[model samples]
Target: MKSLISRLCLYASMLSAIFWPQPARAYLGSFEEQDGYRIPLDGQILSTFLAGDAQFYLNNIDANGYTGVVPLGTYPNTLGDGTHGADLSRYNAGEYGTNHSGPGGTAVDITDNSGLWRALAGGRLNEDVNAPYYNGSNFTRDYVHAYRYSGARTGSAVLNLLASETNLSYAYTLDARDLNGTAPSATAANLIQMAFWLCPSDWDDTDTDNILGISLRDAMNQTVFQVGYTGDNMLQYRLTGGAWQTTSNRMGTAGWSELVVILDTVNNTAGIAVSAYDDNTSTLASQTYVLSNQSLGLDADALTGLQWDLRGGSLSNGAASFKNYFDDFNFTVSPVLVPEPSGMLLAGLAVIALLLQRKRH
Candidate 1:
């Protein structure tokens, strides 16, 4: 009798398994996964409910996809004036410079800021790239890392958004150190804050009303959503003209900090998550914060571009200049998840119930 009961339970389990639905297959390619999340490809249909997805992989200096070749020396250093002058001119002309490219393979027509942006190799002193695993776990082959110079007056990488993309998710693997590969003093003056901005595509710089400089910080304060570090090593976020609310996580520790942000334009909300992998203690800390959009500021629909804004008041200590390293910068239209088939679920439950009743008889 006991053996009969065991056989009936096994049959019921098989009935449920046979009726279960399978998940959608992920896009397969080299450098396709990051931090356990699959980076979407251009024109790939992630869901019929939303538009196709797109991704920008910052794996090479030329902005092309990784080609199994390593770049040499610091980028834009061999270019005009060696101070990024030619590239600066291009940026002023609404370009991404000859050396630095924008997020979407082409530059935007607007000048958002005058920050110095370039690319650097991995495993170098003052900048340590996450090799073998870019996010300390999933993904690899990140030979180049994006550098936002702390010495520049302002630093940022901006890109235009897709037409039907109501949601945006970005990931950056970051490691901060002085020129000698040593941990820099965690002083308030040496703090570096990197924030994301969702603003209008026509965001102007040094416009007719302004004379000398355009305050990127002031402009960021006017966007639909802003989320990033607090410069003092805490994660914080805010809506336009709203007070910044802090999360429970601390960033910019000893080793690499993997950060991902998901923005919902339809709801005017954002979710910021980070996983800090410490090199010294070999430990990992993860935290997340979800900010709801209770009040709307500027119409989120008008906000068509994403901007990475960095600010560092004092970046140098003695002879060593503090460098902020960012790698594997990825942006994709957030995919709408498909719900499980309810009819199949009910059928499986019915099969299991019928099997149990037969055993009782």
Candidate 2:
């Protein structure tokens, strides 16, 4: 009997070790895990950025000719292959050694549905290319930057999908690197609200009822699906009935968090997966959150656009500003499968319970 008890204990321990959840390695997708210079030219639009670089894609289509924002300056109507039209000035170009300190220039509040702006950092009045935005390092590498401008702001894009594209999947890596504040270390200064929204084809930028600068409540009332990150570090989503719901786990304070949203219009459901990496680029096991098969608000055939919003938190002046970094954006017609708790882990727990009961007898 003693020997049987010892063998059972060993088996349970080995099973637990094998089935326990582990941290996931960081994934950078098409973009490199490096820093980048601030976008040189002021008010540069995403449409032109797509026309210049082929690296960005929308629903498997090369990111070019998509219309959502106003043109910043003179650009070639016809762009050649490669990064021809996508130089630093056309994109985020600046002098290699110049200290770019400016209160005005390319930085503009996106009020007229002008899409996203490219800058070195956010929540700071000075748009300095050499500003150390992350961990005492200058901003480098290529990623979309989002933050609160004059009011709340959203980096938006329009999706022109094919008729055959029924269901949709969208994904991006988000780096909630740091928060800038006036009081510096005040507790209220720690948080800023951010969210991602999936909108239907009928989403109009010109709607008078639409608060384009900040909230998406009007859009959310439509067929839009939303995933939100609160100041408390919790991940929340919109239910089919139009109310917001939170996941079981909270996210990490800093690092890259990958969010994938799958919209299934045929089944009237949507799903989301949220995972974050530590400063070391390794996944934080405690921050993984997934909500699958949530109900949708309205029955729709297709989704046409998406928006990412950032709102300022706890601020009287320069203090308490937040920045969100996005990269490796993807969209497709195929289905996406989010990771869930393992069945083996549950089985291992059951075995341990049975063994303990026998030992007590």
Candidate 3:
């Protein structure tokens, strides 16, 4: 009986050693850094959202929320001066430069004040500032000075709004000219923008000349969720190789829908999942696509559409452009787990065996 009890104890100890959970190691990547910029949580101060002046920007708010703009600096351009035209001139600056590149040539600045109907206003023209002309053309006129506010900017009292909402939303106008220019190289450093293609009406290969809607040049490689455009359009997600895969749902043209994509760096796979949601329902509409063993070796720079010849007709004319809006964009460096070798598990088992032997003796 004593020997049996000792054996039982040894077995229990061995089981625990084999099944013990390993501690997850810190994820090694850009998005995982503690100081990395991220969307603010709800109820946080608006001043904290800016790169500087956490308190000053927050303090000047009136009961109605009227603060001034906080300059984010310039937008960065990679191409040579005026190569793609003045439409692409905005890229000559840095990340937050005077020239806006997406929809119009509008540069966006943030404001702590919500009382003002427009949170985003345009910067002065190059000639107005007497800045040197990269392009010799006199077309560097700045117009369309409008104030665009984030979704958070619209909610709450001007003062309370800054203090309460932790996150703000913003969108800019974009045009075909922005998409027609060269695509930048992809690296670990840049944050690339990605889009999904939904083709509901027909998959006619001739009509298939349309480029995938997503564009990423200097974008950080993170998992992003995208929604399929309504209509008879088939939902497609592109991987690094430029190849696309379809989703399960046959989406209709009723309204906007949602899809989730997980970009795994370890396995080199872009895991895609789709779901359909309506303003009226809490139940999720979902589908999953597991794209494994993808050999599409798309370099970061190549994904920008710089090298590929534009298609003919509307696509060739650069008018049949793809448009997408991203919200709640998020990415996380998955914590790494170092697995204990089988030898370690055996060592634990040996120790348990000795202890049991002693107990029996």
Candidate 4:
């Protein structure tokens, strides 16, 4: 019996060594992981981005046809072709760099209902644009409406960003409403809301209803985060799971800002970071939110059920309308390895048994 027990102990020790658990490594930026996919935005077709190389997809739905310094392919007349349509050409030419009418010329016609709505509804993963607004009508039946505008008549534009993969991910949208009177609230269902960060720039005090933030329902129309803005000229974050958790680490002076929320799949946690600089800035502020199994509103089995919302209030005294611009939206999934707890426990027991056997011998 002693010999048999000694052999069993030796076998267990070997097995433990083979099945030891290893600590997870830190995940780098959006697409820095070796195993993760990287989709380069070089004005290529959507098919090029979805050729199976990118693990995450970043869609920038621009209605004014101005995609910043980047020159992406133009979707002509609801078709994913390189040709520029009449509606698209109007804005495409009036955009910043392009030369259509003249220098500093504004493209008012492009901002029309047909041009903007067509781009949103026709957007696709790598080849098309998904139109989120209604044509010739401000009201939408199924999707959310996102728009952007400057202080002037022709300074605003609207855009949408879609993830490449079909999985449940977290995202945040900033609606630039004219908070001169009261705060705004809109229903956002079928979205895994993380938090609403608001920066109120120019608005009157009577506009207490100018709510800068609020959380919405999860991807399955479930409530996850709440919305509340900090005092005018400040930034705020609100939690939605249990008790309402709030935080204020204002990052910018209050205008068009970029709020990024990412899921650290490798560490099984999530984090929210904001950057306002047009270029690079080290002063970017970010807050880390640890996610527990129960706290993750969605179940393990149900992935790819998340959605986003970008509509809520009125703009220009509820006359012109509110508009917001978004770009460079990306999401990544980390590779998780199962740990062998049983093997570790058995290894500890074997060491004890081996020591006792040696002593008896």
lDDT tens per residue, model 4, 114-232: 32122332222112343233324332212112222232112233232222111112232212111111111221211112222233333322232322343433334444443333323
Give the TM-scores of the predictions, in the order they appear.
Answer: 0.35, 0.36, 0.33, 0.34
Task: Give the candidates in order of lDDT, highest first.
Answer: 2, 1, 4, 3
Model 3, residue 130: what's the lDDT?
38
Top of the candidates by TM-score:
2
Model 4 Cα displacement at 102 (Å)?
33
CA displacement after TM-score superposition, residue 8 of candidate 1 (Å): 36
Off-target runs (Cα >4 Å) in candidate 3 are: 1-210, 213-232, 238-243, 250-254, 277-284, 287-319, 342-361
lDDT of 3 by residue, 1-361 (tens): 3334434443343233223442221110011112111112221232223222233133223332432221112111222121111111221211221122322222223222221121122222222233222222222222111111242212121111110001111122222222223222322322222222121222222333333233222233321222222222455555443444555454432333444433322223233445553334534465444332233244322221211111112332223222222222222222112224664566667779999999999
Q: Which residue runs does candidate 4 get wrong by more than 4 Å? A: 1-244, 251-270, 275-294, 297-301, 305-323, 342-361
- Candidate 1, 120-197: lDDT as tens digits: 211221122222223322222222222222222223221211111011122121111110121222111111112222
Report the lDDT tens digits of candidate 2 across residue range 144-181: 32211221112122111111101112222122111111
Per-residue lDDT of 245 in model 2: 61
Q: Per-residue lDDT for 61 in model 1?
A: 31
Number of the candidate with higher TM-score, 1 or 3: 1
Best by lDDT: 2
Clashing pairs in 1: 115-154
Residue-level lDDT for 109 in candidate 2: 21
